[model samples]
Target: IVGLPESLHAEPLETTTVRLPRWVGGSYCWAGAYIAGELMRAEGFTDVRYVEADRSVDQSEWIARGETDFSVNFPPNQIASIDAGVPIKVLTGLHSGCLELIAKESIRSVTDLRGKRVGVDGFNNSRHMWLTLMSAYVGLDPVNDIQWVLTKDVKPTELFIQGKIDAFLGTPPQPQELRAKKIGHT
Candidate 1:
């Protein structure tokens, strides 16, 4: 069922295990992928496994290299993979606009991000790309103006909390943690 988007609902396929990748621990971007794995196991479709899993910037590439069966990726990465002939397709849009830009109180708006340290999971990652677009919209030079700090799997929000960075984009758990501690303003 190539590119059918019915893998979850279709009849069970014979396989030892199906591998799925999570960007990070229960992050909003990859939550659907994780849930799908759990659902597949619950439905007896296949034994779900996670592989090549890390906070690196190339989950799409992992899929292209046959390291995993599927992944949850943002549009820019997916499109770039497809352009590189990765032989992958968008199964569905899980969710969008879930990432929240959490910044210190001194920072007011996207425009104010100029010359400030903005933490991201990785360069050109979903968080970075979205923030870059936001910077462009506010007439800031995305590349030259903002200082992007890469924390990868280390959690940029943690660094932000420690005052090592000025701003950062947080997904599910990160944002929740920030809110619970009343750390930063969104």
Candidate 2:
């Protein structure tokens, strides 16, 4: 009943068709989707399937192109995809208080980031979108005000560890990992 529609509640217990559910990150990040899928299966969906994608692939594109039935991602990225003609719908937010912008010891506050380098997965991805928004909120240009480092092959955590970037915006495991190693501060 959690993720199911009211229309589905009264439907007969029979074979139903659904596009494969897709998600990003490891099991913990997508645990809700998996649990919901399993619940649907228990409720008599005989053909439910899930498609787990690698981090590098754009999971939103999977949903946009109809390769997936549903997925969770940063709201900004989803909105960008919708603006770009992706026929996807945002159901709801799963949780909050997970995303954190971390900085090394030398960088004490947001204002300290002027002329500093920040690392993100890509130039226009979800993390980068937030970074840009935050920069603008602080009266920074988001582009010319700070140096943006692309962490395509290398992750933000690794980039921070290697002293390649001054700050990084990361989520969940990355934050946890950084904390475990005492890498940065939020």
Candidate 3:
């Protein structure tokens, strides 16, 4: 990392707008962003406003467009955006161990995912990216080995429960819900 010029230190801007997620799947990552924005606002350093982008806009796109000052997301997703010429830098590591690849009892492992229908919220979202990486790691071509089930019309949980999908990449509330209802095994 290149060091900033010594003259860069100065009073922070007095007014700013922050962006964060309104959904639960990545909310754990949002905790830090929320506190930092709130603390800045509370300390009178800035008049902060938080905008929650709808599902139509992915967080990486928001970062690329400078619509959001900070957000937490998967590394692969961020790297892909950067490779596409998005101006983003990894400041530091926040946390990990939040994502889980959940599957039904019949699907025992990543290899079992081959020929199975996997549900994801969107076609190229982090979930989809991670699933593809995993599939490739297990010697399966993501496009041909697995049936990609886009869950744009319905949530993955509902589709999984209805037997429309055999496995999915899940986080937080959905995983908790699946466990509570005895729906699937991680």
Candidate 4:
């Protein structure tokens, strides 16, 4: 079933457990975990298990242990899991597209981001990769020019709102929310 963790659905479904994919291909890694939990509870799944399997190898471990009945994973990861002898299936496509880099102030253009601190939710994820690509396209070296602030607990939007981070690399709502708050011009 298609679910959003941050969404508020009135009618909850009847489910016992919920599992999320470790990675959603081009979008982001582990980005759907929270939303999957939200979906599980919203669907009335009392037992929610979040499996951290970024690749097929990790997914195999979860299946071998019988830790979860289902998981949200990339197509390649899913294929790998199946190849590894893990009984798993694809429910549906959750998300698509790469992330974007958003700045608190008016960047005017990508060139302004040079030497600026860019906030990334995680390393090696879509956001991180997007920042790297954006930086290169803008003639900035992600490793040397832009400062990447890796945050584990707080959301990138939250950091942007609080002014703790100059730029955030992620999907919508955060950028839209920031525009709504008049904190930045998207």
The best candidate in terms of TM-score: 2
**97-161 in candidate 1: lDDT tens per residue?**
78788999999899999999998877766678788888999999999999888887787877997
TM-score of each: 0.68, 0.78, 0.76, 0.50
Off by over 4 Å in 4: 1-98
Number of clashing pairs per prediction, in order: 0, 0, 0, 5
Superposed Cα deviation of residue 69, candidate 2 (Å): 1.4
Off by over 4 Å in 1: 1-18, 22-24, 28-31, 38-57, 95-97, 152-155
Worst 10 residues of 4 by lDDT: 20-29
Clashes of 4: 5
Error of 2 at 162 (Å): 3.3
> How displaced is residue 48 in candidate 1, in Å?
5.2
lDDT of 2 at 86: 77
Q: What is the C-alpha lDDT of each candidate?
A: 0.78, 0.77, 0.78, 0.64
What is the C-alpha local distance difference test score of candidate 1? 0.78
Tens digits of lDDT, candidate 2, 40-69: 776667677787655565567787666777
Worst 10 residues of 2 by lDDT: 18-27
Better of 2 and 4 by lDDT: 2
Give the per-residue Cα lDDT of candidate 2 at 77: 76
RMSD of 2: 4.1
Task: Give the Å error, residue 10, model 2.
Answer: 2.8
2-22 per-residue lDDT for model 4 (tens digits):
685653656656656666544
TM-score, candidate 1, is: 0.68
